[model samples]
Target: MYAIHSVLAGLLAGSASMSALEVKSEVGRSGEDGIFQSKGIPSPATNDAATSANFKLLSGMADPNGASLDVLHDGRIPRSEDDPRSNFFFAGGSNGGRILVDLGKVIDVSSIATYSWHPGSRAAQKYQVYVADGSAEGFSAELKEDADPTKAGWEKLGEVDTSGEQPGQHAARLSPAKGKSLGKCRWVLFEVRKNPNAGPFNDTFFSEIDIIDAAGPELVRIERPKKVIRQFGSKHGNFRYTLDVSAAPDLEEWCAEHLIPVMDEWYPKIIEMLPVEGITAAESITFTLRNPADLPQNLRGVPAYASGNSVVFNADFMRRQQTGEAIGAGVHEVVHVVQFGGTREKSARQRGRANRPPSWVTEGVADYIRWFLYEPQSKGAEITRRNFDRANYDGSYRITANFFDWVIRNHEKDLMRKLNVATHDGYSDDLWKEWTGKTVQELNDGWKAYHKKKLGL
Candidate 1:
């Protein structure tokens, strides 16, 4: 009888030790099709064990430009393809980050799922999953990315790599293999990795993570808040506009009163000022006032910036500048919307070409429109005696704006328009000479001489 019992015990132990997992990956686009369901991937769970789990970043830093770690289990997904605030990612240049989810106690983990969205290579997901119950001797909750978790009392579930998939919304589901179980696990370690072949911004934009409990009660889904969008058009009805103030509802009234009128008048004027013959300006533009807390670290101090057809503003900065520089800032960013209307510059830059204009020239033109054309009385870009020595044409922003203004006044009356066209096609220093009959340095020297004489420096 003793020998028979030993044989049965050995069989049970072997079956448990052979547990394995199967991984299923799906990819799709965002819209009415839905991120997960339409692609046959499981929807994220709101009442999953991970919802109440304590998530700790065991390794790597969270990307300040992306959402916080809490977003992974927040049960909310990004509404659009590149919604940075709605997803979490590691800092750009890092290999990737590690996330540990502790469920407090061992439970039957039925499945684990991860979701991510992006319009580029970042849409892919790459990571290994490990599980532990904490009962194993020498178990450590803190596992480094390079360390082998299985060597420290963890079980390697499986490896997930969707890198070969096309760019879009992606989902990965890990479940027990046929006729097997993942066993009871209280801790899950995600060894995330960035795409090695992609650019510096290769960190995966993780939208949400789900951990299902086999014996848990019915799951609940999280409902996202409704977006508040105020729509309007250019004065001549030639262009459409959308103002998304959902993140900063308190400033809605101020936006309507002070901001809208400026954009309604200036957006068309900027398009008219910086026209490239074959290029058409964005017929519709979106202006979003984001909550300061949700903004990327780099954009926290910036008043506003434009991307694609959207202009995003730091809500706090806009609120503080409302009585002063708010309108001017709006006009400046609107100019960027017009400047980026042609994709040639962006494509050239992506291909590592040097044909794009220098940073100063791009910003100078924007400030030229803002300080000189829109509000000359403000004299915001005026270079007086105090800033004369520091005023180089390449200093960017106001200094360059003043230089451009001087060049236009003395050399070329249609310099801004000509330079705008050059920037769209393939800008070069020689183009400055062609436009104004002088090299950039000569133009810079002439502008500085005029400034120095005016300031008596």
Candidate 2:
């Protein structure tokens, strides 16, 4: 588990006040880093880029690592958002909890031209630099005394000097080599070395650290302020909460037992699929578990919307509709949350008809993760696409999901990510051409042939 190190509140004195800043990068607008996590690279609600970066501040122990760091040993975390992005990290005494930085859902490593780390209350404690390209859990860390930025490739860029150390503060600079080549990378990790002479470890404090050349984009406020609620996170990577419900004393325990870890399972991969310039996953989301009545007009919040770093949901619907299925539905809504937003709805018929997503794509993709991560066998039951007769890709959730399942199973596994990135326009057989080198008809034919051979269908 990642530990939380507390610095004298000075480090965060101005943190909450620092609004989201975009960092223009060599990777183009789609590749910049530091936007909010809940909001997509470009928000899906208004279908535009509203915020510049996805910046997330997490307590060390509160990190996704504590719950599933083991995923790293398998050479990949469940999703990219699970990757850490804090350029600065700290530890108290020897065994004190740690204070670490994670990028959440931002992109572009080289864009961070310069950075400084000031460890509060110590001249120095041994530390190391870690790196990963989203292929493994934690980081392949490099321990040393200093880091050098001008190097030719990925190596320790700088080191901190902590000889004859005293309590107060210490700082260091990471080499350009360390931050530059990250253009092709995914996550950066750091850890504090243990001190043998220290007493019972308490907490470690951190001072303010800064990044240069990280601002990009302009803010477009689509609507006014409304009531907000959050999904309080748990130690097991389960972010749980009840919105607007009269809290049942047993709700917490019930949620602990039932709330699915669908997002926790998918976030890391989403981060990997995102452009480097975009925000890390955590920075891209604003988890709220509140009621719609708590909101101003009960606008239904656009089904599920993300205009900037914030993702709003109508919790009232979830609670009232509570069932074993709500978990999967919530996961589906959350996919929309992280994907920015779904297509626009101009009318009830349009909402239910033309404006609707193809059933296989819409539901299958969601169920892919929901079932694979939470209920694998049940997911198998949902993968049967009965509508292969396909006129205009009948816009139904279950059927579309089934087709999507077939697409993923028979063709490219990365297809879901490609579809997600391009949903800003629309998803159709044309998308199949762009991604799988086949038309929807061709894909359907191939899928049918493959399945018939396998199941003797």
Candidate 3:
């Protein structure tokens, strides 16, 4: 009986050991800030190793032919069916592509895993991995059409040909196809070319790539991008755009230097303020600076206006940027482009109300975003002591903008966004009641009273 008890204990211990190993190999874990919790796992790159955690999509990630939508997010997971949109693409009917991923720092790389997908094609996945030390002899940290990554002193660590890989995306393990080990490198340059050995229909859809070492995995710290991306104005291409300066030749240089950056910075903010369906049409937004002499007197006084897909600015208004009066005009105009309420959606029930958000509300909304959100330090929306008596919230521009800011700070945190949706889809003052449980008039009166008390008026 004593010998039988000993045997049972030994069996139990072996089962527990097997379970721990399985968890370590299959579940690659990560934490809040770029820290891998792999803890000596055999496959450390299994978790978010290629996406947000262990690695970063650096400056040089591009296909000679542009890759598909949301490359970073799509490439975040290996064949993540959770989001149909999460697949990085290369142009259709192309052979294959290249992408540079930054590991944030130099480390010994023991293994890597490449994951990809295609709808129905059974093209074998043939690829090469080139390791770089993040020096002059490495792949560019900035994306450029003329970039030649091959000229750099990149060492071919290995090649992987998953010709036996099933019809579409399959799991490819991390073992060098050429060299012994990748040694220590900061960037992994992945190249996939059409194999002369395979038949036609060899296009590729890249999913994810992960690099790992024996010590385990560690996430490429996200905040570290500021060291490289900030100087290059990484926000520059947030929008795909085109410029039409045919009308205003004098404004060409200024538009390239100032206008483009401002639009890129603010367009994202406006998009975040709306629901997915509220996105602006896919048409490229044209920025047309009209010749000063041709400008109408009424429009001449205005800095810029959003007309269809175009944001037109008078040459005179472009010059006002020197005095900082029109520094945020692009922001204000693009806000109009993004605010598509009454036009995009209007049922008979909404149209019968025949109530549009007051012109003051729309203009006031623009100024509030410019003054309160974009450049608060400008104090552009301050209701000064001299104008205190006439400072009705309906006065528009700075006056109404001040009231809008108050509502955002005190009552409804997302007032501007809600107000925009309400006005765009058949506006009425009742929206104020729905948002704050008070009439617009009551909110105005309360705001004035608070200001009067604080200013000792």
| Candidate lDDT (C-alpha), each | 0.77, 0.37, 0.56
lDDT ranking of the models: 1, 3, 2
Off by over 4 Å in 1: 1-48, 51-100, 106-111, 116-168, 174-185, 189-208, 213-230, 234-254, 267-326, 335-365, 376-378, 384-387, 393-396, 404-450, 453-456
Model 3 per-residue lDDT tens digits across residues 1-457: 0000000011011111111110011112111212122222222233333454333333333344434434542234422221223345444455556666776776666566554544444323566665666654344543343455556545554455644434444334444333444356676766666544455545444455566654554544212111110111326343555666665556666677776777777777776775434334333466766644345445656778886556778767677674586658888877777764213433443333356688788888888988888889999888778888999889998899999999888899988877776665677777789889999899999999988988888
Model 1, total clashes? 0
lDDT of each residue in 1-457, candidate 2, tens digit only: 1111211111111111122222221101111121211121121112111122222322234333132222111211111111122222333322423222344443444322111112222223444433233433332223233432112122232233332334333223332422232232333434444433245431222222222222323323223224332354434343333332232222333444554344445554444543222323343345444444334343545333334334444455545545646566556555555555323434332122333345456455565555554456555434234533442233345555555666777677877676654444445557778777888888766656665565544
In candidate 1, what are the lDDT values of residues 1-457, reduced to their tens digit? Answer: 0000000011112124334434333333333333455424556777888988999999999988888889899877776677788899998778887899999988887777788888887887889787888877778889866787877878777667767666676777776544334568899999998965467678898999998888888887543445788998678558888999987788888898889888988887887888876677888889998865456656767888899888999888887888899878989988988888534423332322368788898999999999999999989999988888888889999999999899888888887788787776778888877887889999888888887787787
**TM-score of every prediction relative to native:** 0.57, 0.35, 0.45
The model with the greatest lDDT is 1
How does candidate 1 fare on TM-score? 0.57
Of 1 and 2, which scores higher on lDDT? Answer: 1
Clashing pairs in 3: 53-219, 54-219, 68-89, 74-86, 341-424, 342-424
- In terms of TM-score, how similar is model 2 to the real structure? 0.35
